[model samples]
Target: MARRYRYPFNGKRFIGNKNSMEVHDLDNETKNCQIDEIKDEHVVTFIPDTLEEAHKQGFDNGAYCIGNSRR
Candidate 1:
């Protein structure tokens, strides 16, 4: 049997060498344990008197919200 060569960019085949493949398996138990650390990372709410105040506080960037609820 002849070996095959695979080019990442081009799908064309150029015979002779085989590409090495690597497989990574994540440990679910370890991942679950790490996820628990972030369970308490809740969003903080800020009460700004004005929109400008909110912007000054870095909360008006739309990435953060100023409300009584955490979303």
Candidate 2:
């Protein structure tokens, strides 16, 4: 059987095969974002915060692992 999943954001639920999560600053600045696949996978789509932060967080080229494994 295919896996099913739901992501909750601001008290709302989004259903889909792919989940795009984003974090924006108070002034509407995009901080970091990621796209999660339904098969328990995720990829970094955007990390406009900074390259230092991205490197500190161990993300390469704005793409990396999701749960525990590297993508």
Candidate 3:
């Protein structure tokens, strides 16, 4: 089967922080998300790019960015 997504998951709409284990929605800017606080080292710019994957890896949606949406 063909790949559903491309490489470098960072290009996706959501980004994850390994250190904090929180997922941020790039398209939705929220203060609680604190996207600016993500350090280079903690940034997960590869796999687990989508919220579903992130959550499976024990990541939670940003309180402000993604809100309570589970998608």
Candidate 4:
């Protein structure tokens, strides 16, 4: 399974995926999912020139993950 990370900010939750570059949008997958604290920091790389771009990517990743929880 592809490891997924959640970045919660500004009263919204954002999802990050290694396979899909950039941050996606907040989705049910993240909003309703349980938070599993990881001792090892999950590294999420955002290549976007601005924070907005990264947030957008995270939102997409989250929305997409809801359909594929098997990941």
Kindly list the per-residue Cα lDDT of model 2 for residues 12-65, writing each as its tens digit.
122111233322121221223222222344422223444344444554332222
Against the hidden reference, what TM-scores do the models get? 0.20, 0.22, 0.67, 0.25
lDDT of residue 12 for candidate 3: 64
Whichever of 1 and 3 has more TM-score, that candidate is 3
Q: Rate the local accuracy (lDDT) of all candidates.
A: 0.23, 0.28, 0.66, 0.39
lDDT of 1 by residue, 1-71 (tens): 11112222122111111111111111212332222222222222224323444344443222112223212
Candidate closest to the true structure, highest TM-score: 3
Instruction: Please give the TM-score that candidate 1 achieves against the real structure.
Output: 0.20
Query: What does candidate 4 score on TM?
Result: 0.25
Tally clashes: model 2. Answer: 0
Clashes of each: 0, 0, 0, 10
- In model 3, the Cα lDDT at residue 23 comes to 79
Candidate 4 off by > 4 Å: 1-11, 17-27, 30-40, 43-52, 55-71
lDDT score, candidate 2, position 50: 44
Pairs that collide in candidate 4 are 23-57, 23-58, 24-57, 24-58, 24-59, 24-60, 24-61, 25-58, 25-59, 25-60
